[model samples]
Target: MNETHRSSTDSSEASHTEDGLSGSFEANEDVEKALLPHMDIKSGPQNIGKETSWLKLCSRWPFLVTFLNISLFIASFTLWLWPAPLRHPFKTQDYWKETSFYSPILERFDIPKISRVTNGTLYDTNPPSVLRQRIGKEADKEWHRIGDHVWPLVIGEADVKQLGKDPRVAVKIPEDLGYGSDAYIAQTEVFHHLHCLDMLRREVSYEHCHQQDISQCLIMTMVTQSTPPTPQTDLKTVVEARTREWHFHIYFLLQSPTETAAALALRDAVLRLRRDGAFVAVPLFRVNEFPIGPHPAGSYEIWVPDSSFSDVFFYLAANRGNLSVLVHPLTSSQRRDHETRNAWMGTPWPIYLDSLPSDGDVPLQYPELGLGWSTSPEQEISLEERLRRGAKVEALLANDPEAAPAPED
Candidate 1:
């Protein structure tokens, strides 16, 4: 009986120890489960309370978030709208003697001076040289004496008169006449000249159609001498002489095989007009035969005297076809003359500068910055020479202590 009691007690004690271990494990598990809501395994030490507070603050003041976003947007927009500083392609050479450096180089090198061969006689370019000074001198003198301007209105003369009588007449090119087509270009040229003429007629005073401005009227009213007025009184005359001296170079750019024939016909018509004494027509120059500096490609050049500027302008205005006419002023600088002060009747044809002599002298004032217009004037340096000279000038400036800038305070 004693042995049986001992076995039963030992079994009870083992059961109690097992039950205690299971209860302790269950309690520890419950505690871990409770703590899991506050802990974040992904975001190292838990800042859940701080994050929640921050989110609540943002919710309370939505305007603060909105303001920050708006400020960022405004800053970005301001940066976009701000204008960039002007960038000059060339560095200004203030002290450099451009004329002196270039002139000798041009003279030494037989640079192709801008000269036009018309009617077998080589006419000097707009700015005359010592060799060909007399070529266009007579025309120039006559122009000065009469106080007249030259306006070469280029277009195919209409068989019928009074076509563009109305200044407001809209130019109507046929839909079938494709771009750069002989018929289309011819029609367009006529339309452009007509429009220009109409505009001029409307703006110009009837009495002073020959003169560009009212300076002639001032001269007539103010001066009382058959003899030329003194330098002091002749300020207006000098000003008029400079400004009013315009030469309208009408160029008919021929492209197609048929267009050459058409151009010839137009040339003949201009000759006819000249024969009839309608106007003094400068001889037709085939651009290909005699490639003048910076002249448009595949074009026929014809000039009108200043005497018949108004009449010829009106006549051509009323009757022109697809020719491209480049009407530019005879300014002091040939480079600027073509570039800055010119009007086109039709789309300007790209000049083939590559075909022309590339190594010829260009003016110091007009540097060859790849602009094809930098042709060697009567007195200028070649593009290659100009570049060499430019490098020398830059080197000289760099070495000179005087050229160095003072440090800012």
Candidate 2:
């Protein structure tokens, strides 16, 4: 209250501050504004808590805040690192994106097809979506066109390379609500490609790991070229402008499920295909690599049969008891006379007989329609002539050089 006391107090505060020991200095309004940190924070109508100090949790427990941030980072990293499947009652956009990884050969077409000899009744609809999920990027909308109630089909690219294996890539799912594998197959047709690309007919079994897996669909691609070549060949030789020694064959397989329910789903799909006049289509492969045999049983050969189709069917049944096709009449037979035209027509896999029977057991000697094979022409050699040349060369090679006539005695 007195002048001496006020002077003493002010002097003492100054001395304490100067000595770096003042904890009770009078903080002025402008003094707070002069702070180096948070100086830019202006006091205005926009600044609701002007002059009020902010107490952050980090200031209380810095380590705990740091641990929480690290946990968030780890969680984010885990989501990015491990691509896992999600379960939703209904499919999501992400589900569509993830399912788009697998694709199909052909998506949409108008022609009716039969999958196997004994699938079931015939109907006109689409195949399931699972098949479209197999081909990956190859089955996108830009590369394919699907018809209503039909399945999506791709306009296959002629990749001289990248044969013999399925390349996994991003595939776009159709935005349409009904877009799926059944619709893809029903609607799609390989523009220039036969059901089969002659890549080789191998039984690439599928295990539907999912609940709706279609393991029973009778899937087959019947490729035929009359002295024509199949695609998917290496350019063995380019004589000139003509593609020579081309390759061709059909592809077929029976995919099933790991669980019995999945198996039934597959069987039902086959029955649907048989009933729908649409042959179930799945991943295709090559015949040479097929485990069944190097040569289709004469009875099994759709091209040249050794016995009645019933015998062939029964024989196939006996050997492949696990392999089941719908044993019923379907619209495919009604719309298309199956056995009359193609021996393997009704079945998912139709066997091909080499054109050059004279050559015996050599599929190479036959003139095949090229599927996805690369080719250049040395000169155009007729298929028959090519066979003759190949046969002569084979005969000469088969001869025993050591058995040549010895010098006459």
Find the 10 residues in a row with the least total lDDT in model 1. Answer: 159-168
Instruction: Give the alpha carbon lDDT tens digit for every residue of 85-194 in model 1.
Output: 22223212311212222222233334443565432223334564322221245634543333333332222213111122111232434457553321211122323333
Kindly report which residue stretches of model 1 are placed more than 4 angstroms away from their true locations once superposed: 1-240, 243-254, 284-292, 351-409
For all candidates in order, the CA lDDT equals 0.45, 0.33
Query: Candidate 2, residues 1-409: lDDT per residue as tens digits?
Result: 2344445545654565566654444643333444322453333323434323334543558878788999999999776544233212323443332222222321221223446553332231266332223344433331233212233443222221222211122143454745653221212234334233312112333554432222222222222232222332222322221221211122333222333343334334434543564431221122223323223321111221111224334533443333333222112122121222223323454432211121122232222422111222543356668658866766676667764542232
Count of backbone clashes, every candidate in sequence: 12, 81
